[model samples]
Target: MEPDGDIEIFLVASPGLESVLCEEALARGFRDPTVIKGGVTIRGGWPEVWRANLELRGASRILARVAEFRAFHLAQLDKRARKVDWGAILRPDVPVRVEAACKGSRIYHAGAAAQRIETAIREELGAPISDDAEVQVKVRIDDDLCTISVDTSGESLHKRNHKEAVNKAPIRETLASLFLRRCGYDGGEPVVDPMCGSGTFVIEAAEIAAGLNPGRSRRFAFELLAGFDEAAWAAMRGAGGEGVDPAQITFRFYGSDRDAGAIAMSRANAERAGIAGLTEFRQHSISDLVPPDGPPGLVICNPPYGNRVGDKNSLYPLYGAFGRTLLSRFAGWRVGMVTSERGLAAATGLPFAPPTAPISHGGVRIMLFTTEALA
Candidate 1:
């Protein structure tokens, strides 16, 4: 908040997938990312915040810590908050929404805490406070200490602005990217999602292979912050040069579903993502799914579970057929799947190794079940 050189940057992950997100952040060249309950925290300045929002595919959102202080009471909090250099990070013209959480703090009421900060910002910084604003300032009071952070990503990173059509219960692209990484996918080979609802897995795989930034097509909240340098941001986005050319991408991504509407959605999404040239979508059932005309790669999907779709009792045979089809035709290809029930995954009999930590999606918990190359 005082325009200090470096600030704490937290990359929020899906509730139970912090470890996987940490792995991705480390692999993406973030230094010594430490995993916490909800996210991975690192130390960096505005540049790192921008890069994280732009490049980290697994992060649901990025939060930049602006200030921290110990305040046992609401009046003391208001006094300290008024002293923060809100002008350094926030623009007077752009409105902000304040959200507060209290835990083990003398100031036990979250509403009062948020009101104090809101009044401080409104009176001292001259910024309007609104209930619905793209810029969010979060106040966390825990153990008598208050931490203020700004949400740098306006919309969730999963909303790449690429997919307009979606399935009833679809896997988010951010989670799909992490699941792909957990399956040891590094953009070196083909990827197929047999139950592709809206082409999330296939599109994410294509983007990874092409070395495209997930936030390439979208805007972020950081752009609305004070002292945002547009030229510098443009240079940063182009620093690594453009993505791998579609022509150079020899490997193809395939997605198919029994529903023709899903196939159309996938095709449209792929086209919007500018990867349709290197992707193929078809309307076909799982029984017709087979490896593309190339080297074996990874087969990953988020199949229906009882909590999201059809009845639990009716899904076992679907899982069985999916497993049988893979066993019969997809030797040497690795598999990754997301399902809520262990029994349904067991029905596949795919010999998946231990599953990753359960991930929170929609409302229920699901795990990414994976296996090495099929024997």
Candidate 2:
């Protein structure tokens, strides 16, 4: 596997948002992005993989499929894994960890398969294998074929490395970006999140409107890989920040919550993300929520699902008031609400479209209910 040769790049997306991720990949000029069960796959060299990690907002992480071979049993897997040109990808000086998964294959034991690959890499490639290593080689054995891929993004793209504070049940930044896209946001208008916890939607929107790359502040595992060209990577990274000028921006993203602590956390998070000037966070209840001055844009929120024990009915009044406020004041603005309960969404009475497929977040299944611009 040559580093400059075309290879398979997979952009992992949260489940149920695969198509949304495909839209982003297509918009970003990735070639032939076909949506798979868990992510979008495109063919590219190491440079494309870096751009995917750096510019793509909805991708959870980028995986570079380095090698693949047919292996029926443990011995064959060991032989093929050892024959892989690991020197082209993995650095001998940098330690790596091997993780394996098997499905409908002769080599069913994941631990045993991982051990075989680990031994192969360690003995043949001269790279150290550690249980706690920053670089990882993923081995997927499915239906008698073994695929080896590298997780190019060290930390998940959601961990922008700047947000230091978080409120409970916060939406991941990647997920929030997709939800905003689903709401027809094109970075040209404002967004308001009434029950914004940690200000995920607002901060994400502000960054998007300003044309900032989501991975700008974070380091990636690709930087440690063998054959990494620091100068080339720096040029690629520099070109991405050539986005919309903040001075030409006319809209702002807003967030408000009843808890003052949440407001403070959102402000701090925005400041740390380099998006504070374009975003506003306030302490106010849902009943007091109002649209920001400017053209109506989007009203998206991930409110409490009331899934806690004996807490379902307690949130009805809150949802109802939130709905009434939107219908009464936010004319011409679209709404995208995230919740697990259909009844809770209905409580808003905001004329949402039929809910889409359930999206799993933090082990809980939620759906995004969208509406056209309010009448």
lDDT of 1 by residue, 1-375 (tens): 332368889999988778889998888888779999998998887888999998999999999999999999989999999999999989999999999999998999999999999999999989999999999999999999999999999999999999999987999999998889888899999999999999999999999999989988899999999978889899989885668888887889999999999999999999999888989998988888888887999999999989845588899999999999999999999999999999999999899998877777888799999998998
Cα lDDT tens digits, model 2, 154-266, are 88899988788999999999999999998889798999999888999999999998888888888999999998988999998899664677779988999999999999999
Q: Using alpha carbons, what is the TM-score of model 2?
A: 0.98
Compute the lDDT for candidate 1.
0.91
Q: What is the number of residue pairs that collide in model 1? A: 0
lDDT of 1 at 7: 85
lDDT, candidate 2, at 117: 96
Residue 282 Cα positional deviation in candidate 2, in Å, after optimal superposition: 1.2
What's the alpha carbon RMSD for model 1?
Answer: 1.5
Question: Ten residues in a row with the worst lDDT in model 2?
Answer: 239-248
- The TM-score values for the models, in the order shown, are 0.97, 0.98
Question: Backbone clashes per model, in order?
Answer: 0, 0
